[model samples]
Target chain A: MTLTPILAMRWWLPQDAALHGAALDREMYLALWIMTGLLATAHLVMLVGLCIGRREAKRSIWRLEVAPLLLLTILFGWMTIRAERLWAATRYAGADPAVMQVEVVGAQFVWYFRYPGADARFGKTKPELVQPGEGNPLGIDPGDEDGRDDRVSSELVLPIGREVDLRIRSLDVIHGFSVPEMRVKQNAIPGQVFHIHFTPVHEGRYAVLCTQVCGLGHYRMQAAVRVVSIAEFARWSER
Target chain B: MKIFSTHHRTIGIGYLLLAGTSVAIGTLLSLLMRVHRVWPDLNWPLWGVIKPEDYLAAVTMHGTLMVFFVLTTAPQSGFSNLVLPEQIGSRTMALPWLNAAGLWTTVASLLVLLSAFFVRGGGPISGWTSYPPLSALAEAGPGQATGMDLWLVSIGLFCIASTMNGANTLVTVIRCRCKGMTWGRMPLTVWAWLTAALLTVIVFSVLFAAALMLLCDWHAGTSFFVPAGGVINGVVDTQHGDGSPLLWLHLFWFFGHPEVYIAILPGMGMTSMLLANFCRRGIPAYRWMITTTLLIGLLGLSVWGHHMFVAGLNPWAGTVFQLTTIAIAIPSTAKVLNWLMTLWGSRPTYSTPMLWSLGFVSLFIAGGVTGPVLAQPALDAYLHNTFFVVAHFHLVMAMAGVFSIFAGLTYWFPLIAGRRLD
Candidate 1:
């Protein structure tokens, strides 16, 4: 990557993901604005100070106190307040009870997505039958009628404009399912399930990268996700 | 006095060399672990020659060497061991022998940890966390042999060494300042070091006790953490009925979380000082910045429950842990803003130190942003053990911390050596 001139588009990519409008986005939104103001004001001051604050034959002993204390108190003090507010919001992000639940199973080098069958309950699954067939290990049990209605997609595809409540787990090591466009990410651990919620607003495809390093072949372990309309998703998932 | 004279720089240089060498080694291990996952068949993996049992042994050893011997001992302890006294308007901290003992005890700890590699099972694979059931049972893996015992012994020794070092630092900062060096006027770096020492005094000693209990179970046929019905590799293992595996999590994280701040606070403190001095201006909100660091440390101690949210504890434990973890962000955000504020309206230098500080901010933000997601028990249930965590920790523990250490060494090199290596 070649270094661009200062006039070029700043290297920072703006926050635009769907999840960005909430929790962290609001904080970064304020942060970006404060940063811009601070930068401009500081530059103006530095240039002005160099030109005017120098000795230029003026006799004065520099007395430094109080101004710094008060200024820092306000600046950092404000930061603390903003952060505390965001910190609270980041946790208590209450979800509507009507949200749909999806189970995300993470294993060494692979991901399993299980959507409860038409009954809205997870169907029976046996770990022994899981034989990495068609690249889907931890096979969906064909013996149970619930398995027939239960949808097991090789990859994650969500309907646009619908809330998704995620239940994630790992069969072995720790892993994380991450989608940058959604600005959403979370971990998947063994013998324990973790959950988070997000609603995608746009209809498009995005890369789903594994953010945790869970042993060898970690980089090669990646998949793509597509977001489509509810009707389109129903037709695709119904198969 | 003779050793501290003209050759003073060698001590610091030697410290850097040792630290840099271990970092290089650990980095290689991490990279290789990445590679092994990416291409499991790679025959040339640096520590890849070991079998399943030995592979795990290496895992435990790798974390011990990296976090304790390399990260903890180097920048704050080793760097200050050489430079802080001189910079603080004194010859050195009081009780130089104890300081020397702390260093050697650490070296001894490293020796014991490394020796696990040559034991019967090669090394410990139970992970650096060394969770019980896996660690408590000998049949769990090959390193569970005498190797596991040595790993505990080394950590116990490290606790002693760290406690001693922390005490030395605290006493020196409080008692030995020169006439011109008042408490408020003392460098923020000194404040950070003293605070870290106080934390170690409270946290590391608890670890020392945990290590003793674990050691007793490993040898004296007693079970402090190993629970009943525990079967490793089909062998019935012996463990006391009273001790719970969760105790290790309680003991370790109590020390572990603060231990992380101990790594970061000094680096952030260095950022405050170098940026303040380099900008040719007094630090912005210097007092507030100092107080924010102390606040972060205090908040850091209370947040250990965050790591144990999934440990199947009290039903309400996750909620409490989640809240406390979120609460820590306030002080941290205050820290982030103060650093950038100090650079405002000043004659900023593009020195290597300054560059690393800039890099530090970016990495800290990157690593810290994911913290909230993990704090939620429901959220972490999915994200645990995933690549996202790799991204988070490497950003904070390895990447950001490494950048700060790099900047610190380079900035202090001139002061430590009198002749610039650059």
Candidate 2:
């Protein structure tokens, strides 16, 4: 069990593409190290006990046993406190108003993304008006004034170095919207909207996948997430 | 009275055999899933290429059979029926007829669940959790028709049977102990079984209610779990409206999380019992071990929301669930520390049971350490519904529970069979 080869298995995690990826990877590495140390120490103690201890019945005392457990509790408490802070910061912290906003609606076998146009507001959508492939995949109300300039696309194109807040929903069944590289995942539940925010620090095309078992075409339910430069995003959104 | 002549032991043995068969079949299904993962295009005899529907069916059957039939049946019902009374110096369970009825009912449920594979359109594709409206609408997928209905009925039957066994075990433990067998004098195995039975009764009732509600949504046209204005398979679901899908997730995981403990607590107790026996010493912190078990049981109920963190739960609720879920690690860690300390100053005899016990501890620790990572809603958002969560649970719950079952069977083989396994 050499350390080099195991740590070298970097393919286990997708490449870091989001601003928070480095922080998450660092925490993951730290947790793994702590777990490995604890595992090794426990096994080592067991080995020594087997090799050197007597078979005679010794009255077990609480004082000696409780010491290690108390230490473990302290360590666990410290880790939990640290991890909780990180979680609260990521999950509960309010999103930046300057960040880009995208609405993602997932159906049985496809992902549909909507971007607010120059008005910076999205038009209302009615479930009754939802008719897929009839020029209204997301059921954007035709009569709504703000919806005329709303750009609906199948691909999610984000501007790099800027935070993006995704409001996720499902038109039908439950689906999971996941981008492995960005370390972002949130369920697209029907009748409810889930908010997930991440900033792509790198410019790359990543595969956006549905992690949930949606249906028979679950394996093929995917979309492309292209993080482009600001200029390129401006040009693309204009088109 | 002849022990084997009584219906208690016979029913116990029957449950064990059925559980064994279920495990065997479940393992094969899991193997199919593994094979399909690596070689997606591979075709097999009779089944041909493993289509997505087939894969979903295998996944569904594998989880249902292993969780309900094998894990729940073998450790709690099977072993407790045979050994709990004997450990308490009693001849048989308090209600032998009820025990027999429970066993037979479980067998019937297993049959009904397996029958879905042969039905038209094959077995249910909704996975074991059976989240709706995929599970609610027959037109949602291929197997959502007859197979989903049978799946619900089977689960309902299992819940009833498990509740009966839980009641019987609780009654027998309370009343059938020998005159001198005080609570303190009882073995750890008995304590584990008692706690597990308590959980089974409480949790399975909720599960049964959920199953019934789901059945109503399926057949009786009730809108309990199915939301209105939803479309499945390109058709609008007109029968149901204004229902909440999240309602089902809340109810299901409420029972589901405790069900994890029900599957593992007995194994924990059995491991404690074996550690003491093999090391030729009592657990170092015996009172703490019992206290930890109780704490784990109580804390287990509060942590069910962890499963819903990524399922669109409120962020504040997710934080609360995360805290409770992390609290479980405290008691769980105490149990592990106590086990290690029990073996600290004594030589451990490496019998088959002892080996299994050691393996259980090692595997459990590996599994337990991963809990805190997943307990974080921030982290679970990344890991949920991935193979990472799957591996985490398989290591902690399934593998750990199975190891304890193996340990118990090997330890009690001589007493049960009147001859040593070797």
List TM-score (chain A only) for every prediction.
0.74, 0.91
Best of the candidates, TM-score = 2
lDDT of 1: 0.67
Reference-based lDDT, each prediction:
0.67, 0.86
Candidate 1 local lDDT, B33-127, one digit each (tens): 66666676666646544344544444566677778877777667866666677667877777677776676677778778778778786666567
Task: Rate residue B286 of model 2 by lDDT.
Answer: 75
Give the runs in model 2 whose Cα sits over 4 Å from its true position: A1-12, A55-60, B1-6
Interface RMSD of each: 8.1, 1.7
- lDDT tens digits, residue span A116-231, model 1: 85677776665445556454355567788777677766588888888888787655445557776676666564444566677877888877666654443445557766888999
Which run of 10 residues does model 2 chain A get worst, by summed lDDT? A55-64
Q: Give the distance in Å from residue A110's predicted Cα in candidate 1 to where it truly belongs.
A: 17
Candidate 2 lDDT by residue in tens digits, A30-76: 77778778888888877777788585655445465667777877877
